[model samples]
Target chain A: MSEQKVDTRLWSSKARNLSPYVPGEQPQHANLCKLNTNENPFPPSPKVGEAIANVLEQQAYDLRLYPAPESDDLRASLAELYNLDINEVFVGNGSDEVLALVFASFFLKERPVLAPDISYSFYPVYAQTFGVELVQIALEDDFSIDPDAYRQPCSGIIIANPNAPTGLLLSLADIRKLASEHSNSVIVIDEAYIDFACIDETNSSTQVSAVSLINEFDNILVTQTFSKSRSLAGLRVGMAFGNASLIEALTRMKNSFNSYPLDKLAQAGATASVLDNDYFEQTRQQVIDLRKSLTTQLTTLGYQVLPSHANFVFARPKDGNASAVAAKLREQGIIVRHFDKPRIQEYLRITVGTQAQHERLIDALTAMQTYSEDSETISNMG
Target chain B: MSEQKVDTRLWSSKARNLSPYVPGEQPQHANLCKLNTNENPFPPSPKVGEAIANVLEQQAYDLRLYPAPESDDLRASLAELYNLDINEVFVGNGSDEVLALVFASFFLKERPVLAPDISYSFYPVYAQTFGVELVQIALEDDFSIDPDAYRQPCSGIIIANPNAPTGLLLSLADIRKLASEHSNSVIVIDEAYIDFACIDETNSSTQVSAVSLINEFDNILVTQTFSKSRSLAGLRVGMAFGNASLIEALTRMKNSFNSYPLDKLAQAGATASVLDNDYFEQTRQQVIDLRKSLTTQLTTLGYQVLPSHANFVFARPKDGNASAVAAKLREQGIIVRHFDKPRIQEYLRITVGTQAQHERLIDALTAMQTYSEDSETISNMG
Candidate 1:
């Protein structure tokens, strides 16, 4: 009873009145093939572990000392990885933190900020948290952004490259045009899935690199994460690459807020991940290969698979209900994500897993189709 | 020239608009005594490094999976350390994050929050960052909080117990009375240095011991960090203990903002630090002994030293120039914090380093005093 009696005055208006976002299922079941959360199936580089071990051996006591407040070493390595100067980097707890900082740092007050109507689910959350005015631009009928929509006078603009759930990308040309057109506005490209976006072989048309756009603009900020490709989602490391002035603004806010945002082991582990070029190439290529195979299989089953340049494929079942199909798959020890929102409600975004894991998802789908067919016949006969 | 152009529109009115809090200087120079920041010179427990090493070996691959949105293992260990249930705890990047969350989750949009004007310098920064109204209650003549002034109608009260910069403690009886009187308000006891506060053998008080008060009141939140006492400042870990509902609000905000704030290695290292009681006790005693020695030496050298209950001493040179004393000490490879603000302008807040480090500080101070005395005599002759 005492627990239920929470004093309302103790919490913020937003905290007392928040509808928190629910992340996809991460079940504790041992045998479940989890394809709900878009996580990479591979491990981080062996060198990442080696680097942490090295930090431990040298002076474990250094951890007692505060880490470099701004994570200078990791930022320097990220600059090398992204072909950027150290002045162009701003790292945070995760891409989420980076994005939140973007909203707090540059996207508030003056005019309403613009974002896709159906983009990363966290965009509106950030806007709400910061009390920023929002102008949601609708995606095209095929679930893609029309950059012209952002031409309107706004304080800033944000777009998720190879955006979530849709897995469709905005090309570097389009991003450059958007940035050039809105030269006075702050443009943020959340490239959480850009590693997967750059994985196409044979110079495939699917390759749409948004980071390249940064070279042509002063107002653009590109945010990236180690969660998917480096397979370090649990590590919570993310960085923003932008013009030096933009980075300076974020740095001021970050230091004024939480100085030692990056922990010691994170700085060491992430720096090593950037240095392991072989691991990055190997895992990226594997995910690309797996995505291609999965796309072919889904096409054969008569489903409409979107053109994905991210780690997951968004598709709708051709025969039965998508949610029903997702549930049936779960019954067979498999997990896939289904959004119950407007347009995305009919689709399921399944993360690409290992070969065996993909086979399990395929087998579950086939079984569900067979059961639906049998049920239809039984109902007609009855 | 383009790099010099800052984005005036992108930042929040409060961020680009307001002056930020400057933390203690972290000079780039080598061989400086480096005591301006309150970082422990001692290494963390040996077991902490071993635990991180184990995580690196076993779960480095699992970095692809998101860390538990909340680190349950660390929370559970913290609960065990504080003798509370798992539901009574909330953890974040550091005490800074926990405090920022407090401003966002509990102190926003209510009646203006109250605090000692000379308390943690970050309080007003957080208030402005969150768009909350603030009412600063000035510290007493001796730079200590008189909790009676905090009884005004307010949303919440935040105090750094065994207050920072001054190293003066408010007795638990006073803290308990304040909580009981303001049962309707959220009272946050930031116990960043309480382990050092109980330096005397007869005074074995703990910040964790304050958690027991949670059983009687639902509005009290006690936050402690691994940065200071556990000697894991580089790891960015801190935990808050309060009623379950208060914890839930912070959990919701943390989930909404950054899901995996605690990285893999941090979880392992912090958990080990929590469980290793012997190492914690040993270093805590050493700091206590050093503080006593430093106080005695400073008083003998004609400085008015406050009776410190924390890891640092707050002293004013009897020669009446704390800033000049700090500057002179720094020139001699010694660094101590000198806050050039209204009430504490004449005081120097010095972190108690190792025995040898303290000796070095004492020697620097003795030399500076001798120099100032000679200068005074020469001025008299002139």
Candidate 2:
């Protein structure tokens, strides 16, 4: 009401102080190479489309009824995929939702929850939203997590494996050590990029999912999403694996928040994608290959590329102006992420796009280098 | 791994004390008359299916990308429908999620929020989830909200118009009074059943929506869902309308919780449903007709039916055994909701179904009455 003069002072104190999570840009330009967000470059499985079409055609009437509250079918598929009991799995709108619930259910304590200072940015936002105290332990100079830093007493712990903006994976042994040490606290291993980190092409046995450690550590929770490897970001499906008691706590949080977080089509499509193992393996392998090629090319160009296990590579430019390089790439219709954080300010996190997109990025960088050399010669003559 | 021995004591104190809201049963049998949850008896518009199919066919690759973080297109559609600015509307996975954010945003004050004693059961669960103190204000003897009672100072207020399980509508004037009285606090009017409460058959002008008061009262936030008259419960889309500042607060809360709460297909389908006014009005009018007929029949069968302004009718059986009657109805493959709570335990909330389903329910009730009389005579003779 313009006449009434709206007042924001009525908002809760937490809302006033809230610094919301800024997700990666979703550029509207169709032709632009979108590498800002770590989305899969390939399309989702054909079975996902078929499953959604089937639901629309046959069960259109049932859209009037609420979806399965617990997303039982989706959970069952995830359980089968991970070789876990159905009760040990929990599904939500996305991995973000699952992680948010974990923070609310397990970490809201008088003591602070421990997390890497430079991990997924959403962790701190969740902590703020839930009124949980968060203690940020800085990553080492090499952008690797120091497990010793997490040994102190805390309410809980969360680590994003193959952490965002760093693209570095933590070893399973290190994760197990942290979980074992935090026996009385809930430890969350956010394995959103674990599928991309699986390097053995000949066998699936090399997949290093924290889900394996669930049975060994009662307090450990592993969260994953379909957005990355499964190529279902638009569908909004994510899952968490843990002991049944921990899963039950997340379930309670979800039910209290929104009874039917997953819609019928999301449940159907996500379940189909999970069952399409061949498609999942093929796309992830393609991304993995591209990451290796891109890393080699960047290294040849005098960039310091981090050893990345995720779909994206975190590298600093030779000139050390990450923001300027990101802007130049944007001018050429290529969008890559550049975080302005303290330690990661000089690095750009680029998603592994298709071969053509990668070539475009290389050409743009080469041209920029040539132009800079020409400009230096002119300045020297003057 | 199995020898580690899990412990439940590690769960946060809040999670341990949580009593999650239980949604209505989604029966697996197709033949049962599901008058338990207040779902529309008709299918959604054919355009909804077409819209979803179009998205799948054209932008299947786009599923690899995250959906619009704010659901701007869907929110724009809702804004157009309500004749309000886009900034005044906020969309979520469902009205439940929207309401949950409202609780976390505006009602988490040090003082206890005020709510009607006999209303949607989820209110208490949300209060507990957000750690907000909630004070229950007793409804009038006729189960209507009294504005005078809400006049007392409190942090915020949430009232369901055409309240659940009671199906009695609160006048817009009363809602305006409460909103005006609580100028410094948010007054939420959940208009989930407003479409069914449009009692004026001659004109649309008589449809009572708190949205009208929004231009006058800055504190009134009206929440509605596509799950009701629009027949999209399975898709899970809901919206809230308020002043820009209040909407901004909700957006902050939503971004902090889950960036993309609405999926791509959900956005497409819900937008199409909002545009299909003919389908929406037809199905709601059909339900309104059936509700009147059902009420008359129930009264003849010795039931005191409440004056309903929703798709469901609330009534107490003359025999004063609502649980037994509900059990009897279930035996006949007819399911209705019966809440065993204070002040309303004797009532049965039956959703208004199609004509054939209503006939089946009436026939079942007649048979039960005859059987009861026969059993009573046999007992007397013995």
Task: Please name the candidate that would achieve the greatest TM-score relative to the true structure.
Answer: 2
DockQ of prediction 1: 0.60
lDDT (CA) for every model shown?
0.83, 0.90
Q: Can you give the DockQ of every candidate in the order shown?
A: 0.60, 0.65
lDDT (10s digit) by residue, model 1, range A43-81: 889998899899899969788787888788898998887
List the RMSD of every prediction in angstroms: 3.5, 3.2
For model 1, the docking class works out as medium
Per-prediction fnat values? 0.75, 0.84
TM-score of 1: 0.94
Model 1 residue runs over 4 Å out of place are A1-9, A198-200, A204-207, A374-382, B1-9, B28-30, B203-209, B371-382
Give the CA lDDT, 0 to 100, for residue B358 in model 1.
84
Q: Each model's TM-score, in the order given?
A: 0.94, 0.96
